[model samples]
Target: MRIFTGVILLTLSTTSAFADCGTLNAPTDQQLSSKAYQLQYRMEPDGLAVSQDFSVLFEVCKSDGTAVEGTPSVDAYMPMHGHGMNYRAQVEKLGDGKFRATGFMFHMPGKWQFKFDINEPQGSEQLTADHMVK
Candidate 1:
């Protein structure tokens, strides 16, 4: 039952990601999506640094390639390690679905997942992207 539940959850999450963000195509390594939002990620300092402050920028859009407007949130987690970042990232709106997140860091070298939550007219959904820190 637990396995079944996990499968269902995974399916739902993947479906939601594509439903709102458009067709899945990896033209770059910085884009992620969910049922109601498409998020493009940009990291300041151009790379990952453990235990150091970093800034993230997100350009959000709809599945039909339209700019979105809403409240956006950003967070970082390490699934393998079963833990999240010690710092709580804060997001600021930059108009037209563009947002900036600050004061977050990986704090270790491994696979990290970044999640973006956007609340808009259509409702709220979360998009995710993974980054490998070395």
Candidate 2:
């Protein structure tokens, strides 16, 4: 009986933790998917502006809808210009597969690609999404 109760308590706690890190349902401007994960992100202050620094909040989940674990990183580049962002974005792990990235700036108005990299014990995958700045 005691063992059963303990198991129940542990299960509940684990479920609660995962629930807290539940999949992002909020509206986001950008989303990218790879074979292993799906990512959703939105820039702070709503829109992108040239030469303006902005932050992005993003969430990642596995194909099974479970939060992704391991190291996550973000970066951007302009394929046409063949240059990346002048400032490297700093990533903060918010737990449960959510991350906050700051120090992003789109120096020029053109087609830019946001790169999200997830490195896990199994392997690593990169997801890219395109954004245009006016």
Candidate 3:
């Protein structure tokens, strides 16, 4: 009976963790225009379409929800820029419900930004974060 109880407790705990991660989705701006719930990633420093490579990732959910996890398709950005920039990274999904994106520098850094194009089968999501390097 003790063993049964322990097993049940473990099962419940695991399920809850995954549930917290919840259903994942990606919404492109094209999709966001239509869908009511869509997220956007905005980085600071204005104009330059790439960020300082050493910037900590800043992200937001669809209208004040959870902080995003998984490979953030579009997880970096600068203020007031179009979809043309050089940003490269391999966003990996860690088993513990987190993501690790290995990104490169944009040659030089004064004011840079990056945008990731996180994708789901249903659609694509975007999140942009940027920072400066001294």
Best by TM-score: 2
Better of 2 and 3 by lDDT: 2
Q: Which stretches of candidate 2 lie above 4 Å from their native place?
A: 1-22, 26-29
Query: Model 1, 1-134: lDDT tens per residue?
Result: 99999999988866564445432233478876555456677888678877778898778877655677666788999999999998899888777656789988888999999988777877888788888888
Candidate 1 lDDT trough over 10 residues, lowest sum: 18-27
Give the winner by lDDT. 2
The superposed Cα distance between candidate 1 and the true structure at residue 44, in angstroms, equals: 0.6
**What C-alpha lDDT, on a 0 to 100 scale, does residue 9 get in candidate 1?**
95
Residue-wise lDDT of candidate 2 within 28-82, one digit each (tens)? 4576766567788888877899988899898987765678877599999999999
- Report the lDDT tens digits of candidate 3 across residue range 13-123: 654543443333322321221121233322222223333453222233332233344445533433444333355555555433334455644444444445555554445
- Clash count per candidate: 2, 0, 20
C-alpha lDDT of all candidate models, in order: 0.76, 0.82, 0.41
TM-scores, all candidates, are 0.73, 0.78, 0.38
Candidate 1 ranges with C-alpha deviation above 4 Å: 1-27
Which candidate order results from sorting by lDDT in descending order? 2, 1, 3
